[model samples]
Target: MSEYRSLEDKLNYQFNDEQLLGLALTHRSFSNVNNERLEFLGDSILNYVISLAIFQRFDSASEGELSRMRSSLVRKETLAEIGRELDIGELIKFGIGERKSGGINRSSILADAVESIFGGILVDGGFLNASSVITRVFNKRLEKLSSDDFMKDPKSLLQEKLQDMGEPPPDYIIISTKGKSPHEVFEVACISRVLKKEARAEGASKRKAEQKAARIALTEMDRDR
Candidate 1:
């Protein structure tokens, strides 16, 4: 009971099927019957929920603006941030191999678990129940939405900045990755072929790592300018 209480308080959603909640917190690295299906279902539901909410909330916004806003909210980093607030990482059940390799702290696992929990809610209750949970979870973010919330993703922004300087596109190289599948950390190097600049960063996914490295490169370029 104590084990579940903290998460319940954080999410503000009590589980009718505690088993489903358990499944949600179980990573694929732990078991064959794992959170993957739930993650898939939850991903779709989250997109729909966020899209509809943003669409109705921003009546004057164009399609492009809406899409950008949605991307910002649903990105892996954002989801992992929210999952951290819930302390979901500590609760994730990983296999011995995954545990020894530091899979529990992996942002990708935490983010996917968050989505799986949403899917569990949908299964235990219904769409409206899950929608209520999503609304509650996202209330503050939705309230603070604005034109300022939208921006090109880090990778895109970095690429554009280099191109504007008459430089060749940055070359991204994966330095290494750690932990198990679906829960690995990607270390990437962002190298500017023309400027001979290099920056390295790590993230839960390859794309995220690349973006982080690119962001670092961009910051250095800006500071130099």
Candidate 2:
């Protein structure tokens, strides 16, 4: 035994199928092994678990309200935040190159690893058991999410701020689009109203590109203030 006690202590999941835990911790960059399938399953599992939590947590909330709340909980940022709380990044086994390149600190990578591990737990135990574990991990978060006023869309907020500043509304310009078919990268720039400062970002989708650009704008504005 390599003394896998650290993660078990962290997650409170004593794995009967310890290999599943190992598989979950293994990143694809490590080899031909794929965490993709587990990620897919885990994504669905997490949604269901979170959905139930939302439904029960908010009796007066409507379906749409619950959906929005659930969406907030399951976002990449939220998942990454939870992953950080678990210190899951420290436990992830990455390829030598990836480890050196700071892959463990990447939010997206950490989020995927957490989801894969959650799926592995589901496979090792029944759905109810898995749900129990997931719920426990997320209970505090669910309560916090329920209490907080949901954040407005960043892009929309950015636009509103620009308008209030008496500047022309923000505009997005597509600078470049590249990469293979399924993973095309989009680089976009957000043109600020008064400052004329252009901030750019790259993402896999147009919406993501827009959001990234907005985030850049927000950052630039804060520095000047």
* TM-score for each of the candidates: 0.68, 0.65
Residue-level lDDT tens digits of model 1 in 108-151: 88789989998998998899988888888988998898965444
Highest TM-score: give the candidate number. Answer: 1
Cα displacement (Å) at residue 151, model 1 = 7.7
Clashing pairs in 1: none
Residue pairs with backbone overlap in model 2: none
Please write out the lDDT profile of model 2 over residues 1-225, one tens digit for every residue. Answer: 555677777777788888787788788999677677778878889999998888887887744446557766787888898888888887788999999999999999988978888898889886877788788888887767753353356587678767866777788999999998799999998887654578899999888999888866765664353
Residue 192 in candidate 2, Cα distance off native in Å: 18
> What would you estimate as the lDDT of candidate 2?
0.79
Q: Give the winner by lDDT.
A: 1
